[model samples]
Every structure is written in structure tokens, then in C-alpha cells.
Target: MILISLIFMNVFAITVSLLIIVADKVMSNYGSCKIIINDDKEFEVNGGTSLLRVLFERKYFIPSACGGKGTCGYCKLKVTDGGGPALPTEKLILSPREMSSGMRMACQLKVKNDLKIEIPSEYLEIQEYIGEISVSESVTSDINRIRIRLTDPKTIKYKPGQYVQIKVVTDEGTDFRAYSMASNPNRTDEIELNVKRIPDGIGSTYIHSLKVGDPIEFSGPYGDFYLQKTHRKIVCVAGGVGLAPLKSIVQYWKDNERHRRIELYYGARTIKDLYDHEFFEELARENENFLYIPGLSDPDEKWTGETGFIHQILERKMTEGENSEAYLCGPPIMIDAVMGVLDKGSISDDRIWFDKF
Candidate 1:
């Protein structure tokens, strides 16, 4: 009697396990879904995948600095129909006006059925490029200045201060990382990037390990952080690797002979952290309208230049009002501090363009 009872319980458990496996196979299938983009282009994709993933897989490159994590708020799109309502995670990033206008984070929106999405026409022009590493040199202890020459296209046209996305494949999966172009815009055949090593950062690690002649895949020419056409005096602030885009802008100005009065305040923790100082100093010597100021927050006794936080020094030096436009790129805390300084000087939000990393 005991043996028969044990046998019955074992059979029942086996039956329950089998049922669960069958149920998963049936429920996990979400068939094909249609994605209508910009009302003209259409794609058939498998359902139950994030909209960002689908677009990326299809090579419709979107600017996602955080790679679909929804933190950067860079991958917003307008969904006219069939996208359902916004998720809770999206609410944290989207403004009320944006939400009312059908804006949604593509990373958080799942493709459940046929959907219509509106993306910017400029994004439609973005293309993937194949490039080979031409040079990889260390600018600082942790920062590497990498230059890549386009192989397939042989050329790329992008405005100064714009950035590109580097795709790195690892054992875990593929990841995309964005880096500003440090090379001059006039150089169409090659582009340069300033990569700073982060603690256990997958993208930086991969980039640092790259050797000359290594093949690289990337999509580019994104971001509105480029230098605007303004006669206003320019005040540029950069910290650490944030100087990448600023370098491009300054280089462009040098090449074009733009004589607009410009003042650059670059900050680093110590003298050792500073890179490309000599280049800017030479520019200042050559161009009467350009001024380069390098500040060290924690300088040693050998340091003689400006000391302390950069924002404080900028506030002391900058002339307030609508006559000047400010461009800032740095960590969030530094950006906030600089913004406060700019606000106190009566620089309106519109004239203050910043990229917070």
C-alpha cells in the first residue's frame, strides 16, 4: 500500500512539471507585429520585444546613451497608435507636455501589435559605419584618445560637437556606448574619440583593449550639442573627458578662422589629469580672440594657475547678460553648479547649452 501511494505522488509531480513547460511554450509566443515608422517605412518584427531593441536590430539607429535602459531619456519617440499607455518608468523622464503629445520612451514600450511611430527625419539619415582603429594613445592615466578611419564609407560628415555610438560585443551580450568626436570636422576620413576608463566598464574596457587595425562598428552624427551659430561671446566649460566635443568645436573655429571672442575654462582634479593643454595654449597664442584657462581643483605645490572649483572661478571671471552664450559638458554635479553660476549672471536657459554625462 505504501509503495503504491509513493508512485501516485511521483506521477502527479511529473504531470504538473510537464504542464508548466507546455504552458510556457504556448504563452511565450507573441507572433509577428508590424512597425510603421515615420508613416512611410514599415517593418515586420516579432512581438514582445522592446521597441528600442526592435529598431536597433533593424539598424534604425536611435540615440540611446544608456543603451535602452531608459535613463538617458534620449530615445523618446511619438507613438500615434497601438503602443498602449506609458509605463511607470517613462513618467519619471517625460514632461507633462511630452506625455500629452504622445511621446514615449522606446526602451520601455513593448511591441504587442501593429504600431505607428514618428521619428525625426534627421534620425532617418543616420547610418552605420565600418571603421578601423588608426591610433590609440593614452592622453591621461585613465583616458585614451582613439582615432578611427572609416573603411566602408571612406568618409563621414558631421558637425563639430556631435557624437557617435560605438558597439562593443562581449561574452554577456552587445552594448552600445556614445562618445563625442574629438577630431576636427574637416577631417572626413577619420574620427577621434576620448574614452575614460570606468571601474569595470564594459565599453571602456573594450575600447582600451583595441589595437591599431582593429575593425569597429558604429553609428553616428547624433546629438544637438553642436556649436550654434551665434555672435554672442562664447564661454566653454569642460571637465575630464568632457573636453572631447569642446576640442572639436575649437578646432573647427581655428580651421574656419572664426574670430568670435571665446573663453574656455577646463577643470581637472590635478595637473596629471589635464590633457591637451598645450594645444589650447598654442591656439590662444595664435588667435587673439581665444582664451584657454586650465584650472586644477586639487593642485600640488608645483601648480601656479587658478585653483579651486571651476564653477566658482567661472562665476568670478564671466561677464553676465545676454551678450554671451555658454556651452558646458561634464558630470551632473558640475553642470548643475555651472548652471547656477550662469543663471546668476542672467544667461537665459536658451543661451545655455549643456551636455550632462
Candidate 2:
């Protein structure tokens, strides 16, 4: 009887211990908090969560291309008060200029007490979308220009030239990558995305392997690189797989019959990488306001198109201070070169928007 009592007591103790551990997390309350933004707006929120998650719940969107994984430093908020310490993960992403300005990665800074953080007013305009993969189709050479039909409670409202983060599930776990929405705005039921097969990119590998019926997870309508509401002339530049967002921008123009005189310079190493040219040319023929210039940087003998570096042609075509907005999407190197050329030509920084892959 004494042995039986001892066993019961031990079992009871273990169960209590487990319960306490679980309760500490689920019922762990951090009490009240304050988030002061730009020293103007003060939001009282529950503390003890990362600033990223809290701000999102509060409807203040911070751009995080990596989905709060601390990998992409897009979600930097100025934490002027009550954020604990500068975490090692945050240290990895911060630049000297960002650190000096008290900017910290929102995913890294936990709200130990009250906190003050700075964010762009534009962030307030961003929204979180729980999107499903309605269709994932390959358009060209292992590259997929997938059309993700938004399911669930359905309906997604977004501007052309914006992007979303797809949660890629792998054997290890899940990771995130940003892709531009290539769908036209006329249809809100489904949006489109173009994905390049990165050699070992966790997301792209999984994407390449996914079929039509697989349920996928995604979020956002992020980035500031959209067409400005203006009558100014435009230049759209893109590289290999960077045509995704620019395609969205053009789709918007076509739907609205936007009459801004536009020139698109799409560059690829060869004809194989170039995509959707026929469709774009169709638009050019229909709308005299638009023109298409597809260039093959390193052309084969059989290639019978514009065969020169794209920037050189751009230098000759675009007028300086023409009140033109230039949208670029491509690799970092291409973007920097174009930025330099645009700067030399007196294009204001405000007139430029891009998503560098």
C-alpha cells in the first residue's frame, strides 16, 4: 500500500510539472505596453512578443521579405524605448546607418516592457493575405510563372507591381521567399507569380516539385515599387527572371488603358530566358502609347533582335528630368548600374521603384 501511494505521488508530481510548463507559455501574460510611432501615435498593446508579430496584429505592417525570420532585414523599426537588447540576429542585418538611427529588426526585438518604434507611413497601407496556390504552372525553361488562385475566405485586393511571401515547406521545415504578383488586377479571385528555379533555393525547389492540388501558404502585398498615379512617361527595365513585377505593372496599364508613353527594355543572355514577348508585343500593337524593346545581351547567330547591352539603348532613349518614373526588377548589379545612370541623368530617387532578387 505504501509503494502504491509513492507511485501515485510521483505520477502526480510529474503531471503538475508538465502543466506548469505549458501554462507558463499559454497563460504567460506580459501585462500592458505602449508602442510610440514617430513620436506621434501611441498604441497600447500586450507586451512579451516580438515587435514584428505585435505590430502585425495591430495592423501596422513592416516589410519583412523573410517572414520575420531575421534573414531579410526588411522589417526594421526604430525602437526608441523599452525593447530589450540588440540581439545577435539583429546585429547581422543592421547597417551602420541603421544602427545609429536606433533602427532594429522587428523580428529580433522582443517587447520586454513598453517600446517606441518608427515605421514608414506607407507600412500602414500594407495588408496580410492568407493566399492558397490555386494553380502553379511552368511557363518557360524550368521557370514557373505560377498562377496562385487566392482561396480560403477568398478575394484579394492589390495594386499591380506588388509582391507576396510564399511559405515554402521542405523536409527540414518551412522557409519564405518573396515573389511579384504577375496577375492582372481585373480579376481579384486569383493572382499570379513567376518563380525562377534557384539551384538549391529552398522555396523554388519545393515550388518546382509542387503540383496543382497542393495547398500552399503565403502572405502580403508588400513593396513600394508600384506605378505612380501620373501622366509622366515611363521606362521599365528587367533582367532574366525579374520580369515578374514589371509584368504586373504592364497588366495594370493594359486593363486601365493607361496612355502614358512607355518603353520596356527586357534583357536576357539569350532568347531562351526571354518570356512573354509575344504577349507584350500584342499590347504594343494595340496601345500606341507603349513600345517593347527585347534585347539579347549575348546573342547567337540565329538571334535576329536588338543585340546590345540594354543600358546603352536606355541612355540614348530616356530624356533627363522628363518627369518619368522608372520601375526596375532584377539582380543587384543590374539595379545599381541603372541607378547610377538614372542619377546622372537627374532622375530623382523618389521616381524609382524596384525589387532586386
Candidate 3:
């Protein structure tokens, strides 16, 4: 009698579990959904996934640095209709003006109903490319400079200072991470990127593991941080791996002979971390119009260059000019500190463009 009772109870528990699973599958399924893009293009996607994933799967790449995590605030899209109230996660990143203008983070918004959204016309031109690692070398203790040769499209055109998103797949799932193109934009058949390894970072770890001949996938030419077309003197400040895009800009200037006065200020913690220091130094010596100032915050005994934060050197050496524009890339705190110095020098907010990673 006791054995029979135990068997009955176990059967009851298993039956209830099976029913719950069936119900969940039936309830969570939302058949199909329509996503109208820019009111010009439309796609039929399976509902219940984040807008970011749906768009990417359809080849409408949206720039997202933090995968679909809603932390990077890079995947904002204007949702015209059927996008429910903004999620609390989005509120953390969207500005009051952006929210009022219907800007929503694609990563946080789920597509349950038919949706109408707007994508920039330029975004429609972005394409995914398959490439293979041609060169991979360490630039610093934690940073690597990787070069990829495009195979499928065979070419790409991007502006200096723009970034690309590498698709990373792991047991956790698939996601994309953004890295600024360090190669000169003129190199259409290939590109270079500098990646700094983060502890347990899915994208960086995958990139670090890549070797020559390893195939990779990425989408590109995103971000408005590229150099502007103006006659103004160029002032660039970079910290550590932030040098990637700045290096691209400098190379473009050299290749195109856009001979406006340019000053580059780079900062790092130690001499070892100051990758490409010699390259910039050589360029500075050869080009009378180009100036390179590399500063070390925590220098080793062998250091003999600028000893201090880059901002301090800028304060001393930066000459205030009415027709000057500033470009900065670094940690948020470093960017904030440099912008303060630029403000004191009478550089207006419009004249200063920064990418804080």
C-alpha cells in the first residue's frame, strides 16, 4: 500500500510539470509580427524577441556596443507605433528630448504586436561582412591589434573614427560588441581594430582567441565620431586603447594630405601601455604640421617622456584658437576632465566631439 502511494504521488508531480511546460509554450508563443522600417521597408519576423535581434537577423544592423543589454545606449530607434511605453531600463539612458521624440532602445523593447519604426537612411546601407584574421598581435599587456581581410564583399568604405560590431557567439548565446576601426579608411579590402581584453568579456575573449586564418563576422561603419570637414585646427586627445580611432584619423590625414594643423595628445598609465608610441613620434618628426604629445600617468623608471596626465599637458601647451575643434576618446572620467579644460580654453560644446568607452 505504501509503495503504491509513493508511485501515485510521483506520477502526479510529473504530470503537473508536463502540463506547465505545455501551457508556457502555448502562452508565450505570439505567432508572427510585422516590423515596418522607416515606413519604406517591411519585414515579417517571429514575435517575442527584442527589436535589436529581430532587426539584426533581417540584416538591418543597429549599432549596439553592449550587445542587447541596454547599457550602451547605442541602439536607440524611433518607434512610431505599437512600441509600448518605454521600459525602466531605457529610461536610464534616453534623454528627455529623446524620449519625447519617440526614441527607444531597441534592445529593451520587445516586439509583441505590429510595429512601425524609423531607421536612419544611412543605417540601411550598413552590411555584414565575413572576414578572416590576417594579423593578430599584442600591443600592450591587455590590448591586441587585429587585422581582418574581407572575403565576401571584398571591400568596405568607412570614415575614420567609425566603429564596427563583431558578432560573438558563446554558450550563453550570440551577441555583438563594437570596436573602433584602427586602420585607415582608405584600406577598403581590410581593416584593423584594437581590442582590450576584459575579464570574462565574451567579445574580447573570443577576439583574443582568434588566430591567423580564423574566420570572423562583423557589421560596420557605425558612429558619428568621425572627423568633420572643416578648416578648424584639430585637437585630439586619446587615453590608452582610445588611440584606435585617433590613429585612423591621423593616417587619413597623412594619406589624404589634409594639411590642417593637428595636435595629438595621448595618455597611458605606463610606458608599456603606450602602444604605437614610436609610430606617432616618427610621424610627428616627419610632418611639421602634426604634433604628438604622449603623457604617462604612472611611468616606470625607463620613462623619459611627458610625465603627467594628458590634460595637464594640454592646459600648458594647448593654444586657444577661435577656429579650433577638439576630438577626444577615453574613459568617461578622462573625457570629462579633458572637456573641462577645453571649455576653459573657449572651445564650445559644438566644437568638441568625444567617444567615451
Top candidate on lDDT is 3
* Better structure of 1 and 2 per TM-score: 1
Off by over 4 Å in 2: 1-50, 53-61, 67-71, 84-97, 110-114, 118-132, 316-321
Q: Compared with the true structure, what per-residue lDDT tens digits does model 3 show for residues 122-153? A: 89889999999999999999999999999989
Which is the winner by TM-score between candidate 1 and candidate 3?
1
lDDT of each: 0.90, 0.79, 0.91
- How big is the positional error of residue 304 in model 3, measured in Å on the Cα after superposition? 2.5
Model 1: weakest 10-residue lDDT segment is: 313-322
Indicate the residue-level lDDT of 74 in model 2.
87
Quick one: ranking by TM-score, best first? 1, 3, 2
Model 2, residue pairs in steric clash: none
Candidate 1 residue-wise lDDT, 246-356, digit = tens: 999889878773767888999999998999999998989988889888999999999999988899878877765569888899999999999999999888999988888
Cα RMSD, model 2: 6.6
TM per candidate: 0.94, 0.79, 0.94
**Model 2: per-residue Cα lDDT over 31-67, one tens digit each:** 7888888888888877678888887778676777876
Mark the regions of model 3 whose C-alpha exceeds 4 Å error after superposition. 1-23
Cα error, residue 74 of model 2, in Å, equals 0.4
